[model samples]
Each structure stands twice: as C-alpha cells, then as structure tokens.
Target: MPEIINISDAEDPRVAPYRDVRERDLVGREGLFIAEGEVVLRGLLDSSGHRPLSLLIAEKRIGGLADLLERVPADVPVYAAGQAVMDAIAGFPMHRGILGLGARAPGVAAADLLAGLPARALVMVLVGIANHDNVGGLFRNAAAFGVDAVLLDTTSCDPLYRKAIRVSVGAALQVPFARLGAGEDALDVLEAAGFTSFALTPSGTLALAQVRRPARTAVLFGAEGPGLPAEIMARCAGVRIQMSAGFDSLNVATSSGIVLHHLAEAIA
Candidate 1:
C-alpha cells in the first residue's frame, strides 16, 4: 500500500493536474491521461504498459479500496481528500472516489504493439470516431469481446480522454492500442501482416454471419452518421450486422458489441 497524503485544499499544487479534468482534452497536449473509478484505477495498476504517475481517492472510500491500493506502486503518491474537497476539485459530485493519472511508457511504437501480439489476433480499427463516449463504449466492447488490439486513425477521438476512460470502465487502460497516420496505409499494413480486414457498415456487401471465418481479423468501424468511408470499404471485405430495414443503424458502440461478440465466438 502507498502512503496516503492528505489533501485538505482543492487548490493545492500537489493536486493541480486533476483540477478542471473534463476541460482538459490534452488538446494543448500533455502525454498524461486520467483514469476514474476504482475499477478503472485497478485496471491501470494491473496493466504493465500503462504506468501510473499518481492516484487520488476520497478519504471515506479508502478502506473499500484496500486490496486495489496494494497493487499501486509504492513510490506513486496516493492523495486522499475529504468529500467536499473531492467534489470541489472535480467540479462535480463523484460517486466513484478513485482516480489514477497514467502515461504510456515512452517511445512505444505501433510496430512494437503489433509485434508482441499472438499469431492469431482479433483487432478493432476506428476511423473518424470523434465522440468520446462512443469511443469509450467501443473500447469497453472490445475489452469484453477479448480483442487483441485497437488501432485508431487520425480522425478518432483519444481513448485516454477522462470521460472515455470512465465510460470504458477502464478498458482503455487494459487494452493495447496504437494510432495510424492520416492516410489509409494502415490497411495495407494489416494486409501485409496477414490480417483479413473487414469494414463494417449498414450497406455492407455481406452479412457478418455469411462471411467465412478469418484466422486473423481486423474489423473497421467508422463514425456514427457517415459510417465507413467508401475508399475504406473498398480496401477490405464489407460486413454488416443483420438489423431490421425500418431502422438505419444501431449505435456504433452497440453494433461493435454485436460484431465483436460474434467474432469472439468464431475466434474461440
């Protein structure tokens, strides 16, 4: 367990980074990301690649998190604040008292993430998914379905966003992920790596069940309204979840859950 440094003041310099968390999208860009809740914090501590800088929790909730606390690094500062102070610092009422600040180990590359995977991998690829909540939900779905890794194009929202991490229930911290450049070169890379890429869309050429089982599969999901780009669809096998015609689509996250669940069954 770590030493519990008490935080009585919301403006205390030691707790400065946590202030105005929702506003900090890391747009001005610090490599740091905050993980919320004990479940998410536990995920951060358990992940070998994501290193925690510090942890903060409400004083009243400390006892409830004893086992989770033991997993945090001894050197990491574990700040404990009272309820009022916690609410003041967060700018809202926080039912879940745990928060962890984490960063990816420096110099980690897409290739490195790709290289370590098992021979048969089931991955999710996202493009133009700007909504943090949706992005977070997709990550949660990916984690639930035992996805091997997640690859995001330039247009996707950062999975490390605080809201996304919270929505994911810490799946963002648990899952392996990497980013691709603006171009569609990643598709070619996937093909070279023996991945059978599938672009998911409502008008997809084949129903998901109809497609042959792929040994190493990567499913591409795009933004909610526009869906996957035609160029992207052209680059891979097109797959659709069989939904009723009256409705145009399922929520991106919900569709991902359905697709990945089916894929997981095939993977197993």
Candidate 2:
C-alpha cells in the first residue's frame, strides 16, 4: 500500500504541480501532465510509457479507491485533502476528486516504432490534427480496433493532454504512439516498413470497400476542413468511405472510426 499524506492547506508545495490545471494545460507542464478523474488515473497507473509521479484525491474518495491505491508503487506519494481544499487546489469544483501527475517517457523515433511492428499490422497516421478532442477520439478508435500503433506528424496535438485523455476514456494512455521527426515524411517510414499506405479523403479514387486489406496497412487522416494534402494523397492509394450525396466530409475523429472499423472488419 502507498502512503497517504493528509494535506490541510490548498497551498501545499507537494501538490503544486496540480495547481490551476486549466491554466497549466495552456502553458504546458514541462514533462508532466495532469490526469483527471478515476478512469484516467487508472490509465496512468497502467501505462508503461508514462508513470504517475504523485496522486491527489479528496479524503472522501480514499476509501472508495483503496484497491486502486494498492496498485500504486509504495514510493509514490498519495495526498488526500478535504473537498473544499481539493477544489481550491484545482481552481475548480473537482467533482471526480481524483488527479494524478504523470511524466511521459522519452519519445520513441518513428522509424524505431514502425520497425518494431509485426508483419501483419494496422496503424493510423495523423497529420495536422490539432484538435485535442479529435486526437483523443482517434486514440479511442485506434484502441478499439486493435491498431498496431499511431503515427503523428509534428503538427498534431499531444495525446497526453488532459482533455484528450478524458475524451479517449483512457485509450490515449493505452495506445502506442510516436511523432515523426523534423522534415520526416510519414509515407516514407510506412513504405520503408512495407506498409500499403491509404490516404482517406473525400475525392478518393477508390471506395474503402473496394480495396482488399493488405498485410500491413497505414491509414492517413488529416485535419477535417482542409483534408489530406493532395501531394500526400498522391503518394498513397486514395480511399473514401461512401457517404450521402451532399456531405463531402466528416469530422476527422468520426472518419477515423469509420475507416478503422472497416479495416478491422476486413481483417476479421
């Protein structure tokens, strides 16, 4: 069991990393991130690439989380505070009563990540996806479909963001993801790994159902409005989901789910 320290004051220095979570989220947390709610905390504990540095929970929640607390390493500090103090420390009414400070492991290179995958694999490549919700949703879809990995371009937002983690329901923490290095092309890496790259777009030359699933597949999705750049799509086989006559596009997250579901079904 981990030691549970009682914190009477909101200004306790031990819990400083969790202060003004919303504000800290905007400026960034150096190498640390705040994991909110019970579900996300559980994810933080289970994640291999990220480790919980400390935990802050409302005193009332301690009894309910006893089993979960046992899973935490004995060396990590778990702090408990009253409801008012918890709210004051969080700069809001934290109804969930659970927060964890976690540190990300050193980033893995895209080449290393792709090279580590098995012969039969499915992966998602995200480019210029800046929305936290979309990034989270993509991770959720990736996890649901058993994607081998997710590759993000430099312009993509961090999946470890608090809002993204909440929206993903902890999937972000479970999925293995890596970012492309400076000036590195996603297609180059996928192609080098013998993956058949598919660029999902409204103007795709072939419908998603028409193409047979490859032994190794990489589905590329870009930001919603602009969609995948024509140049990038040109390099990969263009595939599209059949939709209604009027709608030309779907939210990136929704598109990803649809595409991933199709790929998963194809494999099954």
Candidate 3:
C-alpha cells in the first residue's frame, strides 16, 4: 500500500495547494492540472507526457483503488481524508474519491511540434472555441478520429484546464496540442510547416466531399454562435459538410469529429 497522509484540517498549508478546489483556474498559479475520477487519474499517471505530484484519495473509497494505488510511485504523496473533509477541500461532492495533482508538461511550441511531426499528419485546430467542455470533447474526438495533433488558435480555451482535463476523460493528457496566439500567426505557421489548412464553415463554397485530401491536412473549427471568422476562413482552404439546409450548423466539436473521421479514412 502507498504511504498515506491522514489529512484532518482543510486549511492546513500542506494541503493549501488543494484548497478552493472549485475555482482552481482562478488560483492564479500556472502549470497546474487536476484530474478527477479514478479512470482519468489513472490515465494521466500512465501517460508518458503527464506526471502527477500527489493524489487526494477519499478514505471511504480506498478499497476501490487497490490496484492503481499499488502502481503509483512510492514517493508520490497519497493524502487520505474523510468524505466530509475531502468535500471541504475540493469545495464540492461526488468526485468518485480519486483526484490527482500533477504539474502540467511544458507546452510544445508550434514550430517545434511541426518539425517533429511525421511528414504526413492530420491536425485539428480550434478557432475561438471558448467552452472548456467543448474544447475537451474536441480533443477526445480528435484523438478518436486519428488526428495527429490539436492546435489552438485565438480565443480557444486551454486544453489543460482542470475542467478540460476531466471533461476529456484524460484524452487531453494523451493527445498532442500546442497553442497559437493569433489567427494570422496560426495560418502562417501551418503554411510554414507544409500543412494545408482547411476551415470548416457553413458558408463554404466547396463541399467537404469535393476537396482534395492532402498528405498533410489541418482542419480548423470555430465556436457555434460566431462560427469561423470571415477573415480567418478567407486565409485558408474552406469546406463544409453537406447537411439539410434547415438544420443549423453542427456543434464545433461534432463538426471536428465528422472532419476527422473523413480525414482518417482518406489517410488510411
């Protein structure tokens, strides 16, 4: 069994890092990512890119994590506390008794990421996607549909955000991503990387079925309400899914799934 530290006081400085758990992003500290639920926690620990600093396991549910506990590094701290105390620390209930703390891996630069990628790759790029859950789902869908990487453009939420990590079910931990600060810069970077960027838009002139699937493709999606910026879409190749005219556009993540699925098939 891993060494367990019994935590009694929620205000203890030793547990300070875990305090005000509900509003963690507002904590002002950088590079911290939280994983909740045993499945996601285990995924983070097992993934090569992520390393957990510690874990807060509910004392009542330790029995459920016997196998995972055995696999955790002996040196990693396991803070065990009663349900009420755990609730107090996290500022909520129903965490499934397993939360892991880990330092986020340093972000990879877009240039370096492109240099390291295989000659032919498929990347999913998010444009102005603000919802963390939607961003997380996009990562999950990208991973599932054979996207080689995820790129974030202006206004997109951080994929490593705590809610994003949990919402992605840890897929964010495993998927490769890099943030591009501006839309113009993102397009230039993709071009320099030898990637053909495709913007998915409802008003796109070409149907998705007609576009040439390149050996290297980057698919870009924006949020639902505003959709892709007209200026941004003008700078890249454009394609839209053929759906019923009366039906509104798909959610950004779902559109990404559709694009990635087709791209995966094209690549295969």
Q: Say which candidate scores most in TM-score.
A: 2
**In the order shown, what is each candidate's alpha-carbon RMSD?**
1.6, 1.2, 1.9
User: Candidate 1: RMSD over Cα atoms?
Assistant: 1.6
Residues 62-177 of candidate 3 have per-residue lDDT tens digits of 88788999988888899998988888888888468878888877878887787778988988888889999899889888778878788888588888788887788888988888
Per-residue lDDT for 33 in model 1?
Answer: 87
What value does the lDDT take at residue 142 in candidate 1?
99
Query: Which has the better lDDT: candidate 2, or candidate 3?
Result: 2
* Pairs of residues clashing in candidate 2: none
User: Each model's number of backbone clashes?
Assistant: 0, 0, 0
For this target, which candidate reaches the highest lDDT against the unseen true structure? 2
Pick the winner on TM-score between candidates 2 and 3: 2
Stretch of 10 with least lDDT, candidate 1 = 104-113
Candidate closer to the true structure by TM-score (higher is better), 1 or 2: 2
lDDT of the structure predicted as candidate 1: 0.85
Model 1 residue 212 lDDT score: 60
lDDT by residue (152-260, candidate 2, tens digit) is 9999999989899889988888888999988899999999999999999888998988877799999999998888888898898999889999866688898889889
